[model samples]
Target: MRRTFCGSMIALAAMASPLSAESYPDVVSTSHYVPVRDGTRLAMSVYRPAVNTKAIEKPLPVIFVFTPYRGRSKDADGKVTETAMSDNLGLRSLLRAGYVVAVADIRGKGASFGHRRGFQDRTEALDGRDLVEWLAKQPYSDGSVGMVGCSYLGGAAFQVATTAPPSLKAAFIGASDLDKYAFVRNGGITAQFNTRPDEKPEVDLATVPMDEDRDGSMLKAAVAEHAENTPMGPLWYGMPYRDSMSAFTGTKFWEEVGPYTYLDTVKRAGIATYFWGNWRDEPTSQVILSAANLGSRFLAGPGSHCVPPEGFDLPGEIVHFFDHYLKHQDPDYGKLPRATYWVEGLNGTGGYVTSSELPGVRSHPLPWFLSQAGFGAQTSGAQGASTFTVDYDLPPAEYFAFWPRPMTEHGLGFAGGALQHDLKLVGYPVAQLKVSSDNPNADVFVYLDRIRADGTSEVISFGRLKLSHHKLSLAPYETLGLPWHSGFEKDVERPAAGEEVSLSIAMTPVSLVVPAGDRLRFVVAGADPRQRNLTDIKLDPAPRITVVWGGQDGSRVDLPLAN
Candidate 1:
């Protein structure tokens, strides 16, 4: 049976700095067509703060966002709203602080002309550069620009920042991936979320027409042109290898489309970059820590994807960041810590921790050895192995969850001793397992869960690896001191039947404080319904997985404990 669950991204203001509705200035918004060098007319919406019902004439720093999701959409009642604009958490806050906000539909998605050649097309980056230069020259703009976005819009910000536009001064990215390939095909397994076959746009959704195009004549034309646009799903599914060439573009699409491939360009530009990420958001938190040494500031929160923890003034942080870089105000700006991450289970729900050095800088590895008597801090001398039959019928723990799935029921579970004191896990956890499978290939999933003294338990973090993609390599970019598997075509090493091999799987990065008397549980599984759907990985005729323990080839997990 199939099931589905839904969750919403939520944020609560830590401090209220409400702009009285009566005293708030009016916002005057207008839409126009900005032509790129390729003559594609990108639809842009410009909003300027007003003084006493009159649009301001003075120049101000512009905050720009380019998104594939409709930039400006109109509802049936003729009510219009900016899509993905709430990523800032406080849009009016930026405007009230003397900043002009601009939102544009990336080519082909909304009321923008031209087909998207590929996912996050390189051409779009050039278009971003052109838009930045154009916005800088606008009468209301102060020749300085900053970009703010989450997810895809964040990708756009990174892509555009790589172009190094002179007018671009700073950027704030949230819940975005550093490696596009790693994100879409995470851990060398295809992600099911963005790779659904031949998806279509929602019927009720409508793009807001540009000024003077109330009849939507131009909007219709733009929609018509979008029919020729390429779908990203097939492209993502087709490219299993990082070096795989896209049949559509006849180029290594992953490299061309990835912002990390051109990370040096962004570093050279020296844009004041700030990233906000969530611990529960797989890969995004990993990316933030990977880029920590790039001279970028980041806030690693203890929330799910795009969700912020309570009592954290996320909007206030954004305002402060922009105020420091864009306005050159705030005397205590540069003194802020380079990295700030939320530690879960602290002070009840959580609290923030700041570090002058990058995350995991002062962390030391705490290795736990696995055995039949459950895991222990000391290594076992006995040779033992556990075997479990693969059950494809069983659903993943927390099946159909929009949040992180729980450990599988059929998984082999081993528990460590109850903690004598509160143990803080602050970074990536690496699982080194020696295993043999009856099948030529198997998918390995490792979950780290916490079992409370009262018997309540929760999954902390999990990781998966397609056995065929287990070969390690030197990473092109920083990997937060975790093991790096290239997932390149050349590195694939599939095990033969009954062959034993060692796999170093890097679990997703997380920050949590396991309280005293709570025991840590490590679960390993050969099958996960969600991951199987993503990769359609084939199982053996009668799959029986064996995990070797004790001695030199024993399975173990190295946890990053903060000093």
Candidate 2:
């Protein structure tokens, strides 16, 4: 059986109240076809607070959301409908706070008329700027606009913010990837998930017809144009290196589309941004910390992907953030620190700790050495090594589960003695391994686990690196002293067979607490069965990997531990 832990944030999350019909009233909604600069039309759905079936005419701040997912659509009966609650990007919370909300579709998706030259094309970002300025000019808008979304929609806002639209005063970004190059091809390995393109609807059900497309003629034309839209799946697999160019875009496609490439200009725009992410989500927290100089606020919850933690009102927090930045209202958001991150295995206000500076800076490094006897705080005098054979037929690990089964049990395992006291781990960790492989190139997977007093163990964090792309260097941006691996072609070098190479692999950032009796365990393997070997290399004869440790220059892991 697996154990589950949870922390409560009811008091903090209760700052914003739940929506009530009497307090918020009904919302009046309308559909429109907004035109971009290139004569392409984008679909927008507008919702405003109403009284007695009539929309309020008073100007109010607008909450803007732009996404590739169908923002608005017309049913078979020709009735316009907004996206459902889960996909609306906190529409209810924004509306409950008495603000106008507008959601728009990207150029080539969801009833918008245009063709996508590439994934997250620059053209779509320009369209976002045009739409923001247009929304500010609307009669119901107070000339103030803010963007909100998670995942793809959150990424859209980041791209548009790079354009620096004057009316885009602030934004609420959640679980977004600022660096596409790092996201899709992390550590020089292409993720199987990113290699797949977004699913499309059939011609008859492509998207909803805009308000002006009475006979569905315009909608038909838009669907026809989508046929020429470039598929990102091929481009993802085709561009193996960070600097690889795409013939379709005729540029470094990944860097061009990534918002991180335009950080300087984005800083000049001075958008009061609020980033939200979970430790188990995409490395949005890393992006938030990297941009600490942007004078932004962030919330790093302890959850998976876009899901919020238990008893934490996620929508309520969004409302509080917008109330201060968008409506100029005096909400407690201004009274808090710049960052609030959740510490696992804790409860109440203590779990959600705040700090003026970004996370990872205040912690000290604690080194744990690995040897044939297992893990220990002190290094061993005698030199020794552990070896494991690459299992081509190993079972693939489940990707989306909250707790992974013990796949590393079949691999090389090391364990430390039970902790005498509670151990608190904070920030990023670096695994320094002296490894040698029979094959010229091998993918290394490291798993961090905690062994309970009951003898059961659970995974805490994991990291992977392709040996060929293990070259380290100073990051182009701020990483707060973390190791950076540049996956450029020039930096690529394979280790000679059986040659010992020292690798400092950076694991995922984490905040964890292990009880007094819990022991720390490290598992090292050749490849993760779930992840595809994007290197296009083979291990036909089943290569053996040996991990060298002990003596003066032994293998160890440096963890950031809070004092």
Candidate 3:
């Protein structure tokens, strides 16, 4: 029998579900701790339609999500004294679509027991599997289960899906990193600047007291214990730990369960997966790697780390995907692969279009070699062009701020005001350069931007490469194909005084239609102050950069040609 439901009806149900008074869906509305391996009890919440006495009796497929946030209701004083389920828009959509939705607090947060651990940790996967197994046996569940979430939660979904429990069927992972080292550390270069190492562990934030005098000491002690233990130990310990005790027992968990270290093993598990990400999301590219490795479907859009209407039709698309895969109603589900990208315009007005694949267009290699007079192509061999000594002692370049700051007192201004350029690129662009540095190792920062006729320029995309780790391995390279996988791995050792070397740096994918008068510019530098300020790292003899051209050394840029 076919059942019909309206979006309006779902919205109304979400409002009255006791999850929230907000206009969006508020499906899940309470929390409880579910016990897992080693006596660890994890917190979880369930959101579904209010029982309709007149409704049909068939069971509904279940959608389970596990996040670090607290699942509890708050009082007028902004204090959370009672357990309440999450009320996210995505869950509401799932419930309205007639599915039972469940949200779990992975071990070590909210009402869940155990220590706080990060994504892809074995404990997380175990708890996830246990949760699905438990849910499948429940009367509310239709015996089928799927997982969904973004960022850390998305990563958790990826890990749990690989477990392939009998009841677990599919997953929707967005803005997640399959290769933890590359995505989080950027080739071992950590973003220690942005992340506060001392931040409190992931716990029931609502239950935390605002008055430090009351809760400060307990919070401090908890954080200190988490920091001291670190989650990586149990992960690498393997065997008894892997099969027995919970793997999540502390913070700094990423240090232990490196995603890249176990991707091959995980892929062999063969769980049906739906990988989603955004162009702007730093780690999103990793999803592509997962798709290619597991031969799963990949869906990408334009946005940052989080999914939304703020992004492309992520919530709706996820619902449809889960419906088809988990519910098994649509045989032709998610069979299409469209690379939908947004193009930024000169006037700040842009739209999105879908292409068959990345690097939609093919273009001839355009060589822009480095010379004493800036960048140019080589006409002949070693003798034809001027050879300047490469050193890192060049004047320090300031970071490029994407948005204007309240104080103009900072940052380096672009030459000739903002060099505005409009670009109508259709494919991938690669930058190849040749040169030997006095130092064997150095990081290259490649920035792509659109400059307007007026003095304003916005960075379109960028890519980085660590020179020494250039020996590409097929297995590791496959991981790099993922959107979230940043290829930079290890620092290149300092080069012999005059030995020359060639390097290939990948540029970020960009699809845009610039106004006729705008300009597309590429800036090659050592550090990007806007995104990352390397003011702290001291360089010896400062690395010198030399752009190699086809005729000069074997340097060239490969652009994906338009179909």
Candidate 4:
């Protein structure tokens, strides 16, 4: 059913010969604006091999990328504040590989013009199809086109792939969120990361400066909604529950976001895709969703949301993948399995495995019981139940500071005992807790941490659940250690003061190798201002809470192990 390989640049490089810049001619960069069907134009920056790079007599496959986040920007006075790819995506390497690399700003950002919609805008999808068709018709194009981008750019790539554009050949994406609901509000709880703009502080404006003939029309309107939708923008992420929830409740986010992972629609599209996921970055679960829906080749590595591979040639890997798919070349690259991942805690052990499935295992469900004595993950036996108070009315204190501190430091929290032995937690974790509350609903925050003999602790994963929305939902076709909530259709009821109900909380997927001696701790509380990012989001106000740990029969955490 699967194949496995250890992750290493040396292994990936063996699939194909990396392109050498010395063997190619100089590159020529071109900036232009092409009109879409609506008469609006998109700004594209293209890098092509000069005559010296041995441009074949025929057209070549094109790598098209469209992003809302500006890779290029200009100051207020038409000054060139940034060129492009300042983040070092290694675009030049692709140019040397004999592929045309084009980066564009979706309708609203960069040098393009139009009313930019928030996250996954469908109009951008249409714009992407138009761009792909336009590039295919170009004299330089060999009629095939592929798209690449990470994070926001990856979001753009998904937009294009879902359009089912015939000119689009393949997509190489990284760190993108396809499902708006699951991505923005996991299990009906909002994400804190959306509140602020990513740290692209190199330029203040979203639009890059371009020549009058090359850039599109009124660019200021592009940033208008962006400014209103970004950092401190209450409706999307920052203080989401405050005014934005009620204000934008009726808005259709799916329409603006178009088709993405976690939906059946994306599965129908025909596109060869190569994706990348970081164990510590983005939503690792989404990677599983895409691999499941699209049947993609996914590679796992270290890096935050924006980074590619370190020490290895990410661009070179991209070139080999493109050549195999777009050029129809038969190389060992196609022989590799669909997935590859790095092993955690294996210092120089060179632990990398390749398989047909994503990193999370589907076989084992290890439950660590919650007890009165401690957060008992020992698996030996459960103590009694634990009780904690929840005061939604407790005059909000400094919630920001609480996010960075360990759960033990949270004054209103409870922590379980450490692990009984050295454990390796390799996938997303789920907390199946039996809880009761005085109020009709409650907001439960669950956290996972690793503790060493030296007492230094590192938080590995976190999960959130809203009591009213705690009804069980199982996904038959998907798994990454936890089942997805059926949805928030019918709110569940609380246990009339004395009775308790089961709450299955799904934490973000994670990879960790705990030393045989290091222990894992579980933390639970009413609210965590920052589930994953820095923010001041509180619980939905509950007066008191109780966690039932009926010894072996009671509550426990089921952790997915690497083995």
Is 2 or 3 the stronger prediction by TM-score?
Answer: 2
Tell me each candidate's TM-score.
0.91, 0.89, 0.72, 0.82
Please provide the root mean square deviation of candidate 4 (C-alpha atoms, Å).
7.0
Using TM-score, rank the candidates from best to worst: 1, 2, 4, 3
Residues 27-101, candidate 1, lDDT per residue (tens digit)?
667788999998999998887766654667888888888988787777768786664235344555566556788
Candidate 1 has which clashing residue pairs, if any? Answer: none
Clash totals in order: 0, 1, 46, 15
User: After superposing candidate 2, which stretches have Cα over 4 Å from the reference?
Assistant: 1-23, 73-81, 84-88, 203-206, 215-217, 290-293, 331-333, 347-350, 396-405, 532-538
Task: Please give the CA lDDT of all the candidate structures.
Answer: 0.75, 0.74, 0.52, 0.62
Error of 1 at 524 (Å): 1.5
Q: On residues 1-563, what C-alpha lDDT tens digit does candidate 3 reach at each position?
A: 11223334443212222222222222334344567767766656665544332232357788888776554434558664322222233566566566777777656554455675544577778788899998898777889988888776777787777566788878877767765555444533443222322234544443342222263454344333444334442332221211123344543344345455555545565456766666565655566666655666666555655645343555566666776777665565545554455654414676665555533334334444433333333332342222333223334333322221211112111121222333355434566656555555665555555566774766665666555544443444453332222232233344565566655655655555656555545555554443332454536556665544335354444443332
- Scored against the true structure, residue 560 in model 1 reaches a CA lDDT of 83
User: How displaced is residue 489 in candidate 2, in Å?
Assistant: 1.5
Which lDDT tens digits does candidate 2 get at residues 280-353? 66465455653564567877888776676545667776777777777766555577788888887654223877
Once superposed on the true structure, which residue ranges of model 3 sit more than 4 Å away at CA?
1-28, 51-58, 72-89, 117-119, 192-195, 201-270, 307-311, 334-339, 343-349, 355-423, 426-428, 476-494, 530-536, 540-551, 554-556
